[model samples]
Target: MSLSKLGITGSEKDYQLWISSAEKKTSYPLTGHEHPYGIKMSCIPATGLLQQQLEGSTSASALQEAFLEGPQELQDQFILKPRHSARNQARKQQGKVSDKKTVRKSSLKNWAFGCISRTREVNEHPCLPPTKTKQLFGAPLEDVCDNDTLPTPILDMLSFINHKGPFTEGIFRKSGSIKSCRALKKKLNCGDTVNLNDVPIFVISSVLKDFLRNIQGSIFSASLYDKWLDVIDQGNDEDKIKATQRLLDQLPRANVVFLRYLFAVLRNIEQHSSSNQMTAYNLSVCITPSMLCLSNSGSSENFTKQISFIQFLIENCLKIFGEDITCLFGETSVSSDNSNITDITDNSEKVAGM
Candidate 1:
């Protein structure tokens, strides 16, 4: 058979040599009637072109490029086969899975780091020990003093502010020097006698706020927080006042005494609103957060009501707390103090009489 018929450009001697080498390297039959490797003889031109490039360059890269640049039929027969397509799809899926795992790990790492950072911050600036806090700042009113009287530090600070802070502009609204406040706190915590008169008016005000803020259960008590908010939602001022009075009657005697004293002081300050610019409303706004254990989920409307409730307390201090000679520092027992008490006193008496 002529070598040219097989698409070989070489002499018969070269074709014989090529055929001998192919027979040794491959298991394909080389009969002239059929193409080796089961391909059709008519498609030999594309395969023949790839073979020619491989013969010209003995490099494996050139051989691969030849197959890649060959005709579509040749490419489909070799590189684009079903098995290769499946393998490529598997690799792409694996890469996507790896990417998602990497992203999840990164997010988890960031979350862990954030939690650790917050923990460190808390450790670095931890709150005072419970015993120390109770000693220096607050305890339950009943636990600390007799006759529903204020804690010593609280009473001292309030009395000083009452005497010197009423006419001070922005009494509770303004912040004092942080350094001074801390120093005063340190002194108080150490059981050192702190003369409020020697401290700045703003500092004394700030210390009082700090005291209330650090109190164990807050002045109003957490159990009563929702009820206090509900008091503001009452239909009218009359109903609201009555609700507030009932709530006040529910307080532990110590809280009632402290509340009465604190509101009396706030009312006194509000009376000097012309000079201080801290009206009952403003005082309420300034004092609410410290006095109440605020809820994070509470809406702005609830906050407004909280402020309004506080404002009402300040505006009607005597009516809500009643007028007891022993409300502040009096040593009279709860039973004996009832006679001088007014609206709230009447309700408490009714409850007792019941």
Candidate 2:
């Protein structure tokens, strides 16, 4: 049959036809001129008519039977089958997919642990001035002051500020010289006697800020930071104070003592707001960053609430933390001794210069 009869428009030379015999035989070239049954085709681009003819005619069925009975090489060329190696390769590809998924999970877990470790570093081991004693900057409160009191550097700085900072303009509001602050911190850390009289007032203030900021976990510990902000959401002053007092009670004794002492000093500064221009609100704003370990994820409103909480503590210095301060220090009375607080002055003398 002609190529046109096979519904193929190609030249006769473009196609090859083979006839499979019942008897095993070597291959033979196509004549391209005759139709034959039991013919196995190769390189035929159009198989639609060929398939239809095979299905519809008895002779085509005989051709298919002959094709199956022919040599194995003829069968291998015409048939498609899955190879054993191909299935094994598919299984290996599936294992690789599973390995990628495992790696992703492992990477995610490592990232989470890394975040946790960084947070712990910030909360537990802040960068601090080199010191010989374990009870100085960046030390835990329990280790630094088990008797429920401020650390040496903290009390010294607070005492100095209480003595001279009240009259200084922009006492805590102004930034101090960085070099001076570092020098003072090194002196204090080295257990050297530092007379507040010798250091510049601004540097003294900056050292105080640094001390608070670098304290382990901050004065308001990281665990209590959220509760402090929640105090601002209270409906009234009484409720807020009540909430604050509850939170204060939850603090370690050293933190409570330091807070009371620090606020008392700040309260003294607020009393001289006319001269220093640092009111309770301004003092709160000045020291809030140092006193709290604020997270970068916190909103501005949360910061505002923290400042409000601190401002409340300053304004009511005697009311909120007063009794605890009294119990801890064994004071006979509640007094704002700006010139000579007994505990602070006594401690100051140990580190004070001639």
Candidate 3:
């Protein structure tokens, strides 16, 4: 049939009647609007299906089988020409949609347990971190394994998991869920449902410290103050343990790159003591909160909690190691030589007799 035979050019009433009739027979949602030219829209899939069904029957010998046996009034109503995105798109793109602003709400559980939950969801990766190619994910390994850069997925997984664990559970278990935390955060009429029964608030607060530390050392600087600013917005690793302690003291709630150098210093100590297991365990306890904090990368509570934990550690480290041997760990510094050389030789001779 020719385009002229479809009666596509006509008054708006003629087009509306056809649209109404097509919609009744089509399963696909149908919509049309008058353009400056004429009614235009993409063809609904159902329209073609209807045409095929019609062509198969004897009564409608072909779509060209005009209903000669029926009333002549509706004869000029059939038309087909397609244009436009979709009706839903029109409602969204055109100004016909509602004016109220839409706000998104996420789960409080996401904030609290978000990191771990997300990690568990994607655990199907075959090779995890500590593998030969760990650096690809920006994962902070103490020593490069062999000769690989890292698989991209492994890096992503490590980056996500190592965020500062201490922060995740600390904030999550307290708030119940990530959504609840955000609701409380936005002041959007949230109800009280924070849980703190069995979980120790201090441990959670400590994990937050690790989060603070990782963010802080991500820069190159001399002054603690500059490093302070680099991290203060998120938090400072230097005083994570301290800030964490202070926050803990307050209300009962609460809350990388350099890590290679950290591992080196720790390794030196282990070599002297002939032990690595205890050191690893101690560190695991120290850094778990940080990993947890990273788990909820969405939570700012992770930042605060991390800062305090690091601060507490620094204070304790000073007391634990003392001012004398503490300075030995710095990169470009040297220890003072002792003046008791003769006394040391005499001690060696005395020990030989035993």
User: TM-score of each candidate?
Assistant: 0.53, 0.55, 0.20
RMSD of each: 24.5, 24.0, 22.5
Candidate 1: Cα lDDT at 255: 73
Model 3: per-residue Cα lDDT over 210-313, one tens digit each: 32244322211112322332333444544544543343233211112232223333333332222223233344345434432343244556455444433333
- Candidates 1 and 3 compared: the better one by TM-score is 1
TM-score, prediction 3: 0.20
Identify the leading candidate in terms of TM-score.
2
Better of 1 and 3 by lDDT: 1
**Predictions in order: lDDT:** 0.60, 0.61, 0.29
Error of 2 at 257 (Å): 0.6
**How well is each residue in 214-299 modelled by candidate 2, as lDDT tens digits?**
77877788888888888888998889889999998888877776777677678878887887789999999999988864666368
Ranking by lDDT: 2, 1, 3
Worst 10 residues of 2 by lDDT: 112-121
Q: How much is the lDDT of residue 319 in candidate 2? A: 80
